[model samples]
Target: PAAPANSGPLTRPQPVSLGMNAPAGPPTWFVCGAAGAGLGPADSYDVVVRIAHPESVYDLDLYGGTTDPDEAAAILAEALVGDLADPHPGSDSRRSTTVLAQLLGPFKAVHGRFPSVPELRQLLDGAAGPLAALRKALTATGHESLLRELDARERQMGHPGDVGAVLADRIALLDRPAFAGFFDTSGQSRPFSLKALDHPVRVRIDLPERGHADASRILARLVLAQFTASVTVRDDRSLFACLLLDDATGVVTPEAVRAVQRLRSANAGVALTLRTLDDVPRPLRGPLLGATGCRMAFSGLTPWDGQDFAEVWGKEWTEARDVTDRQIIAETPAGKAFTVVRRVITGKAPTARAVTVRQVERERWSASELAHGVPAGHAVLSLTTVKGEHAPPLLVDLRGGPRV
Candidate 1:
């Protein structure tokens, strides 16, 4: 049934609580933005997750504002389907053919300028059989159009001297399989290096589970490769990864994990989101947690999660109890409002650890609750300082014109 006309706007009821054993790996950071702030109409949210360890480092952003829910979902689905089907086993074969064709064009043009027709015929005959037939067809016609066509075809076939040899060299060098082997042997072309780019900033978009996985993966690789290469070649700067994740329920696949791991290994900064701690995948729990040092928790109704947070604070305060306790008394008009106070720890001391756990609550939107045009809920923005000193801006200005 359709929702009632007077029904209130949609809103997340409350966050689910997590247990103490909430995955021991990397910290899984999450954010649930309001409709316009970070979440979009396509049932998507922007997220950023970063992981840094002593041996390895990873930074990734799962959601970029530009990707729509449909597009993202489609990419996810396509990746899954493609992996299962394993289509196009020899797609790289075409690259060799293309390089060969390119080499042929210049070769023919150079040979075509020969002083004698016999020399030209000899050169053509010495080439492939199809090339020789093509030359004959052109000579027999003598028409300017046919000659021009033949010349063009010959040039495309390649330059005269060792054209085939040069093609072989390039094929061995540029072919994907060969290239992979070279990298494997040389150790310079690891999976991390394959996707590395030279960009100061890289924007990544994480799609919802319903979106196309393949398309999203392609889009991400293209954007990252283009930006990284352009920035590196043009500016000679190291590549940086800026990412966003839009998973309402933080269920990610093994492929996603591997892809993200590759990105992080390249020293890219990442940002991602999840609806709750439980939504995080079991396998990814450790790496995700270890990567993200900064965290933000919004309003949650789950008692267990709240209690877990309370315990963290309790441990921090354990040392404070040992210190000299101070007492204070307060008087009220209604009655004797007496209160006892103790010295509160503030720095890196054991007692102060618990104080770091901040209490955050969800915010409500102020616009008309029943307005047809208004977005669902009010957005809450939280910033975490991960690897860098500066945090990216989180603006919520609707009047800034449409986003491309």
Candidate 2:
């Protein structure tokens, strides 16, 4: 269970204490991995594992409170370029991302903060016309490189606008009246930056999924990108930073997978839940599974989702038994008489039994079993530690029952 929000300064590390308060029940087997040393004389700890409390929690800000404008723009571009419509030209998409970063960086530098949603739309639609003030600020500061980038943006405006149109439509979702008070860089609301993750803080941002799903998805992707980037560059790696996305349907991307791979060294981790493997792009399904340290398949997953889990968990050798029975024929009259007497008492024929046992390879958890054989409130889970140790897939009881 999470401790209450901590506010006071942490002068030293805090060790987690666990009490043995088992309730009365039948004996149950537990799959225990070696605990890290930080667990104290009461436990163990590894350099890769540290415990820290969360200091603050807030919704993700597109332009996080980072001094580097380029980093912020890159994060924003990544979120925009993801989930683009099919038939989107690759070159055009690249140009859009490049121009967006170029314009966003200079604008944030010239002004104090990120542009509002409507201002962002104007910047994308007509950079030269609407951002004249930004251009003047750059020229006055002798930012020749930024001036050239602005020129390039103007030149590209003359080209096909497919990518720009696609991105504009997405931004339009947030520009509505429903989101007027939010996403404003003018300080109408408090801004949160994932870069401050070095401090121990718990944050929960509830998305408005009821009416603004597309906007919510865009914001979710933005939050995910910022988190991956922030955790990578944290100055203090002592605190174990973690991000949990309850329903990460379309937010999984190749960059996110690579970031997950790097979390072990950064002393951070991310937990993402999905309704189905179908939510993940077909090409990334295998890579995502292989990248994560832990994999879970709940009781209600479809056979296809189960098949993916089955493949990753792979097969193990188990013993198979075969039994055969053969009727005995009496060669002698005495034997036949005895057989008849026994048969008369038992009311059945006498037979001899043979047994064969052999080792055979089988799936650890087959697709059928994962899809239908698991009981309600149970799931199959496999875990891997930071030291590269792993535990085979095992059935987990979610409702505090015996785990196998």
Candidate 3:
């Protein structure tokens, strides 16, 4: 018998809380006893991992740049860093000084050293001159102010307040290693190079964890790695380029999403490892998932995350039922059937007989099941296709040697 129905608060079972599954063990890796085989640059991939700890030196060279979502990210490695912020290379007053330094590089190469303003102008006049196209584009873009600023910076390159001089000085300070040079083939540090490719050299850079991390610089380097790989991969499909980023705290910009969309065609890939989905911004959750086609979710995803994944996998027809009445029959003293009532109950209570049961339809794989059911070793693998059909999800074991 059930307790008396009351107007008091109803008692219910405690809600279930998911457990955090510990990793199986340390990662498996073996030392190479034989002579080291270097990875070719053309077949190389650059991976960046960020952790929430002491910052690394590689982060110092970060330069955050952006592009419209409707537009693809573009990078001209041979171009100056100022170009990162503008599609029209020399169109920003803020980067006038930086632009002059670019022209100065070639000017110095042509002559024995730095050229005069007249010499630089003469260089810009050539039919195939880089600055000619830039200036022409500036006029087309209605950036008269930028052109004026460029003229001002060129004339004041040697002045203390000169934009070009200031930019050149800043560049000198910023250019420490190959990390700053996007197109630099001879990346001075092996730790900062790509892993392996069919090219002559590969580079890898591990951020140091000994000091306070620079948020802006770290973000810059991450964008650089992601954008550079994405750009080069498109130009050269024969090369294998990738970025393995760990602790990607702030990589979810429109540019990053666009990069993911564009990378597939370029034969480049960027892999990021984050602590939790909560670490990412809310607006980007769908895009992040959509960009990643093949996904394996471990145990203990939050209810929201589970719901998101559940929705992706979709709903299905499942068996369910409802209760109507309860009826029981018995013979009393070998005569006939009799009914007995032990306790009085509410209107929905079953009669003192057979328990009531009815068939009803319900959806399967409720959000809670995904958020809490599976054990530590097992994971749900859901594959999403471009055509929008989700393959039936599969359960997998992380440490299992192989699936025969």
Q: Model 1, range 1-404, lDDT digits (tens) per residue? A: 01111111222111111112223222222222221233223222222211111121223221111123332222222222212211332123233233333323333443432112122223333456645665565566554554564465456454544233332332222223211222121122221221233322222232222223333333343233322222223242233433333332322433344445454334443344554545554445555543443332333213433233232222221222223433333356332321212223322222222223334432132112112222332122223443344332122222244321
Q: What's the C-alpha lDDT at position 291 in model 1?
A: 42
Rank the models by lDDT, top first.
Answer: 2, 3, 1
Q: Give the number of the best model, judged by TM-score.
A: 2
C-alpha lDDT (0 to 100) for residue 2 of candidate 3: 9
Q: How accurate locally is residue 98 in candidate 3, as Cα lDDT from 0 to 100? A: 46
Better of 1 and 2 by TM-score: 2
Candidate with the larger TM-score of 2 and 3? 2
- CA RMSD of all predictions: 21.6, 9.9, 14.8
| Per-residue accuracy of model 3 over 1-404 as CA lDDT, tens digit each | 00112101111110000011212221111110001112112123233322221332232122112221111112212122322333433334334434444454333333334433233334333324545554565567666655664455346544543344433333333233422333122223222322223342222333332332332233334444434443543433554444434334444544466567776565555555444566566767677777766555556666777766666556666545444455434457432212323223333323553344555544345468757885665667766544457666676664463521
How accurate locally, in lDDT, is each candidate?
0.31, 0.65, 0.40
Pitting candidate 1 against candidate 2, the one with the higher lDDT is 2
lDDT of candidate model 1 versus the reference: 0.31
lDDT of 2: 0.65
Query: What TM-score quantifies how close candidate 2 is to the native fold?
Result: 0.77
